[model samples]
Target chain A: MYQTISENQRHEFIAKLQPVLPEIQYYLPSFLDRRILFVMNKMGFADWQNFMSYLDNDHSYDAIFSFLMVPVTEFFRDSLVWHTLFHTIVPKLIKNDPCHVWFPDCSSGHEVYSLCMLLDILNVRNRVRIYAGCKSQQTIDKIQTGVYSAQCESMLVANYKNAEIPYDISKYYTINYNSLICNPELLSNVSFIHSSSLLEDEVPQISLIMYRNSLLYYTTDSQHTFITTMYKKMNFGAYLLLGIKEGGNIFGLQALFSTYNKDLGLYRKK
Target chain B: MEIATTYKLIVIGGSAGSFASVNHILQELPARFPIPIVICMHRLKHVNSGFKETLEIVSKNKVVEPFHNDLLEPGHIYIVPANYHMMIQSDMRVLFSTEELVNFTRPSIDVLFYSVAQSFGKNAIGIILSGAHKDGVDGLHDMYKIGATTVVQDPQEAQVPTMPQAVLDVMKPHYIFTLRSMIAFLKAHI
Candidate 1:
């Protein structure tokens, strides 16, 4: 449904895009290129010039942000990571006090919802406060509606099974009109944050931040900035969950935080 | 036979019966193979760790499952992790995406091959090994047309010839190498 920018033309696009979308300046060029092409093609933009002209003329990008960011990707993507989080990390995070969880890049909310089901199963749903970060209200509304294609049901069930969920996943959602409607109670302990970015947001006292598959897109400088920012905001005993690929000390921020589980990308704030 | 063209990255795409051939190629390579070899093979997504571990045991070079923005380094064999589409950047960094599936697979060889062709152009080497799908054909075509060196495993010897046959049907690759000849070619070039 969309056209992609050629690799030859990437440098030019990055040059044009940085001044406008400063936040994405540090994103890995390949990933940003895909997202840019997706937005331009989906928005009927003939080329980068046309896309830029529209952005210049419109002076608004709420729609662009909606189109650019991906939503509701793999649920419990790496089941081992999810298993580690529930079994190992969460217990330490919620040692005594109620835990405040953050999802700084909560695109479309499937991951957060997966956590909601997990938290509910743990019966500590009442003790955790989840902050689902959103760039626009469209995402909030979409997540609140909690409707997904029935086609994806098999994968969800499969991931749930792989994660070794004790309860049947079917109880959490009902299929209607070829859509899976998540139970409304899933959002009981969740709070939506419009502040958008963890880098800029001073939202404090987070016990855990589920920032998986996200840091890989960031440039080294931005990754350092993020680690530094989280170091300040996260409580000393809090935890951070990155993507599984972020294993083996790739982030190299050990001075600030200790590696709780290197393979699963779970860390503890020192 | 010596390959005349200088290359920066070598990306190998395989599936089904290519595992043994891939193992052969990696096992034969010396410790300091300068060009980074990126292997994108279709494996069971739920079955992740074992494949990497098995490859590690056989290969001389260090096998790595790369994250997004992992800088391409010499002497390391980058194996595309299961369940994610892996791509290469012009800056020699590996990238990952969970966006969607292509050709009924997540770590689609086409995605990685096409991305490398676009980013590395003629400097990259594209190799198609034995498999049962047509995933790498279009991607190999892209790399071939872009002036990158394209090699297809000998279809006659391929355990599952569908993938190699599919590539042969589209465009004749620069070199059609058997398992031994491919290792020799790689060792000679490096």
Candidate 2:
């Protein structure tokens, strides 16, 4: 006998599964099949057994999905973006003192490191205040520890070279068994907020908001809502850095921000 | 540690079928190969997601995406990230530019090859692999003029023959080999 999952049943499954599998829920629309497959493989069960077990245990689909959606990042993955920001953007932010920079959905903290590197290179680490928010506390802890893999170190070295920033990157980390633990001094001026992107009630007025490459998975309506929230949070003339392929005409919100084609597609609030 | 007086740097340029070629070459090289290998592959804009991870998995040596102002280090593979032109400095530092695209590619093969040739001169090795357009032709010629070792993938074996054939049409390289043979040649040289 073959059992079919109805749309309502899927929605019910998702609603039941969200709390335990937050990542999977976030990635559901885009990653349903992959998440299902991952859970099956993890449980060491065939398809039928896995489905029966999930059904019997009343397993939260969200928990299962969260386990599947990997949020891996490396330090300074894209160096040009950091270079443009340091050389062009941060200097402007420094000129406008009492600046606020918001990183919504900062996942782990590579984006944070990228920002810190910029502030350090520009010699204005003191001028700007950073507010980074993410949904996962585990990610926050990882960010707090500031430990990264050797792969991250290699990437960081490359980014430093590309930006022409002179800093001994090796000096920032102590090697321990193929892992590089970042110095604690780097996190002194930054503030970490453990909050969900969906639940944040009040966003402080910010001069620069960097939401890189994470909005691709959201539904069209959700993306509009998120961008609208960002528009509300940003002060006039605030700069927003988005993933290259992300900003498009969703909910006719294109006119709200003056789109600049620096590094493909970075937008500045008008 | 015996420091070699002269360091040989290899810059590989390719487009359409470059990824497979790179994997094939890197897989054949030993982990301790003591030379810097820089690659400039025309990548789609804003899609700088999996190049490094994929390359690192395939290659024996450490593979990473090049960052702005990074110093060139030996025993590593550096890939030019998407949407930026990668240039090498005489002091062996990396230079990144968002200057207008060359031959419609931001990470243009010609840009990297020309700068590397200028920086390393005779110590530089320039390789032109499979590509649809003739982006790296002039850069390979510049390498030839500067007495640098130039190699082009045998057109018959290349996925796209135009790029390698274009270089062969202008100046003869020191060696021409299929991808497999090219790996052997590079391994022997390094």
Candidate 3:
């Protein structure tokens, strides 16, 4: 029920891959071969050179990125992680002072909206500013439109229950025909920005960054550089959330941050 | 003479009744099973904790749910983690994605099979097992189109015949195996 794509998806992947032949060149040699061939097969391209023929058709970039992307994600993904964010991290962040949350690469608006609901329920929505940054204006508009398939309501409700956030799920959205329109007031303080790279337009004085599942798209070096940039910009003891699969494989940056929960990819700035 | 070394990889996919079949295969293989074997069996996203451990308890070879960008090792068994789509690169690195579910299931059989078709092609073995969905048909067909050895679990022997039957409805695979014959084929090849 939580699956949706951003219009900036093509551009964002292009931005991430612009470095090396659409960035496949920079993938660990092993990753490059594995993914290239996989993509070729999925798209019915005959071979490597045929796949590389993407340079010939600009339109093919979208198709290529679509295959590679874990592009759409659900709300309250890894419910345990959201629970920890609400019960443990939010309290700590609020105790420090007025706070801001950045979803540095929010391809889908569900997670961003999920966080807003939690903040509103905590009655701390007034104290916090949320910035939802996306690569394309289409995604920005989609977030603003805020409608979801009615079928997704049950899934979202289950996730909310699992996340242990206390609130009536029905109060957030109203049903129309076959869709649910999220209440727009949730984002009264949330700002939408058309920025792909956090390295370029990062908002300073950030208390929390929900940059999960998006990191693996970059080559390892790019991953490191992005992390290092984020590390320097974050506030003292600020919280960083990563995808569950990413924490262990990030190579060496373990010393730069301490893990709040190794199981859920929550890290605290050193 | 061992594991028909001509094939570099084997990918198996299923839903519903595939667990026992997968468990039996892992239980029978020797420790040095030769080339890698990756399975994409569907399971609940929230039921993530003990699957790999359960498989390892029955496997002669080490079993793992790969982390992102992991290099696949020969003689090992890799299970696609829950809610993640898995694929292989030409270099044998296993990758995972949280993309929209293909065939309405993550750990899609088609994603893994089509990927190995491109990566290993004729040098791979693609197997379909018992399940309730048609997920493995296109993937197995991709492998067949690429000249990889393709096998379907005999629908008559399948716990849920829909999946194997679905593949049979499309095209003939190289073999139609019962779980017992499938084990014998592997042991004989080794």
- lDDT of residue A63 for candidate 1: 78
Candidate 2 docking class: incorrect
Model 3 C-alpha RMSD vs. true structure (Å) is: 6.0
Candidate 3 lDDT, tens digit per residue, B12-106?
Answer: 99899989899988998889788899988888886555768888999989897777778899879998878777879889876666766788888
Better of 2 and 3 by lDDT: 3
| Candidate 3 per-residue C-alpha lDDT over A47-113 given as tens digits, one digit per residue, 9 for 90 to 100 | 4445445645454244554444344556677889988888888988998776988887777688888
Clashing residue pairs for model 3: A33-B90, A34-B89, A34-B90
RMSD of 1: 3.2
Candidate 1 lDDT, tens digit per residue, A16-75? 555545567777666777777778777998666677677766644667778877664656
lDDT of 2 by residue, A1-270 (tens): 111344554566566556554433544242344344455566665755456557558543334433443443556656676767877888888788688888876766777877776686567878788888766566677788988786667666766677666666666677788887877677777788865453373557889888765554554466667778888888888888875434443333476788765343478787
Output the number of the lDDT-best candidate. Answer: 1
lDDT measured at residue B80 in model 3 versus the true structure, 0 to 100: 85
What lDDT, from 0 to 1, does candidate 1 have? Answer: 0.81
By DockQ, the candidates rank as: 1, 3, 2
Candidate ranking under TM-score, highest first, comes to 1, 3, 2
Q: Which window of ten consecutive residues has the lowest lDDT sum in model 3 chain B?
A: B1-10
Model 2 C-alpha lDDT per residue in residues B36-94, reported as the tens digit of each score? 89988877643445877888887888886654446678889988877567778777766
